[model samples]
Target: MTTTLPPTHRALVLDQIGQPLRVETRPRPQITPGTAILRVLTTGLLSYSREIYSGSRKYSLPTPSVPGNGAIGRIVAVGPDATTLQPGDLVFVDIYIRGRDDPTVAALSGVHDGHTVFSRRMMHSEWRDSTYAEYARFPLENCYALNEKRLLGSPSEGGLGYTVEDLLYLAVQLVPFGGLRAIGVDMCDRVIVSPATGAFGSTAVQVALAMGASVIAMGRNTETLEKVRGFFGAAYGEDRIQTVPITNNVEQEVAGLSRFGEADVFFDISPPEAAGSSHVKSAIMSLRHSGRACFMGGQREDLGIPTFYLMRRNLTVKGKWMYERGDVVKLIQMVEAGILKLGQEGGARTVGRFPLEKWQEALDVAAERAGPGERVVFNP
Candidate 1:
């Protein structure tokens, strides 16, 4: 499946931050000595992309960078000495950066000053050809095998039909599960999730349920809560899921869930409107001794957390970034195996669709809430 292509391909390129992505007939990226080329299948824009673009997230984006971190694609070309992959292999690639030989373990662990890859072989890209295009060039170690059939399935009932949204959501929800054996999550753990309607929240609930955790989902809309419940099969039966609408007094809601404070993990994806950074501080107060709370969204201001509470509880506060190459493969498996479900109303459906030519519109739709099961997708 080696891809022999024309000299150039269509891609969305950004010359600067806060600028529109221009569709250009740029030269297809060549395979670097250690890299391979992939024909784009689908790529996901997780919360990090927006953060990186705006300079608010932990990761940085150099000017003239491509915007996606994870994508599923088929191998088109392989660089010299790249024996692990071949032309026509389906794979999911990671977003980490690769640097010249480095001395620290953090380089392999994804900690480089701003955009360097973690390991000497681990690769990171400062926007070198992303999934928003027809083809991408990736380092050999950064790519993982993907099942072509599963990746190509339709979303209709009985099919995985996952979109970039599903993949991105999977990436976001699985961050806590990475890094080594027994990443500290188990089935039936007490879990609390916030900002229940957004794509991130929706994924959190799905992952918690899949992992066998009891979820207490928070949001300001009963309608949205009901929608979420329906997605999990509670609409026809008594809801195993619970919901708390955001009221004027969020502290009260926070206090109410404190009874379950001994929760093993609390996932926060709420915006300021539903639960602000203070909400996480409060969640820390309610956590069981040695419990962990993960913040999955951005906070505009410093969140005031009482040090005494953290010290006494020994709380572990983690802010998730994005998924790694291997995580994406497992997520695709979960979806294909019928462990995870997606859709617009009852199942996964597109909220909006934009051609590659309308890149800005796609970004806008992704940023705003258009409707239920709404996700803006780019079909190149």
Candidate 2:
């Protein structure tokens, strides 16, 4: 219960690493002890955020900093070790902080400084300011809550009318729903999402078809893989979605992912210009023997794993990062049980909407609509 207390706001600082993002005025974050205080409304504008603000991705981010990361707010204030959270609730901040006594010490607030020395002193001492700002604070377990009468109430009152820029596609669907829940994608599983079509592999082919799995989606962008198989094949169907193309030719991409069948999970996020892409060993040789793989991309080379065919196909590879606060509370309960649709029924579409002094035309329309459900927000 704390809302009337401004004492200064507006931000977007950055002041270092090739500088040029001022906007100033600060001073509004004041709730410490397991923090809380937000009001940020909508923030996501990543598309490589100009290679992490022009130092060309050296990214340790600890400048005069405010930058930005996951947001979508309205808590206003909550410290004293907040329990159920109050003062207007409508959360989802999670800039992946971690380190309340070493959760292997993490940090991503205002975007990464994490690479240990205790995650670069927890991103140069305690989550260095984020969410571009109009009031932010964070921590309190990375602030999750978000149902606000079924997302901004309406649908004749039963709500789900959604619109906080369609919850900014939960920051691009929480990094492929944390690598398809770290390769345990179940329900009718057959998964395969390779390069799927960028912007987090076309939202990991719509979060592996909203976790009910049945995708194949690979990529070399054959018309954005048939616009991601006609926008998630008209709501998860067209035989549960399939589209291959990445012909770097590992046996013609394992015979085009074995003409769609033996997968059972093989996610691969691939992107560091997909280093030596053979579509990640033809989706780990088209999965299936006890199958499973996850590899959340940004590919820093050397992923040539064929190691005796994953030890004779007992497969199961892992490597997930950036998720688990119960995967942002099960991705907002899979978007409030409507099974994951958000804005334009999940193929998203904001394309641009800045403020906070048009953050360089919102990072150039988030790098020219980064693709796959292109959204580019700010509204701070």
Give me the candidate number with maximum TM-score: 1
Runs off by more than 4 Å, candidate 2: 9-12, 20-37, 40-51, 57-66, 75-87, 93-145, 148-189, 195-206, 214-249, 252-269, 280-380
lDDT by residue for model 1 (247-300), tens = 545477677666544567667776543434344655556667887777656555
TM-score of 2: 0.35
Per-model TM values vs. the true structure: 0.78, 0.35
lDDT of 2 by residue, 213-240 (tens): 7898888879988988887888888899
In model 1, how large is the Cα lDDT of residue 124?
33
How high a TM-score does candidate 1 get? 0.78
Model 1 spans > 4 angstroms off: 45-60, 98-127, 150-183, 233-239, 248-251, 258-262, 270-278, 323-326, 342-347, 370-373
> Clashing residue pairs, candidate 2?
none
Best-fitting candidate, scored by lDDT: 2
Worst 10 residues of 1 by lDDT: 103-112
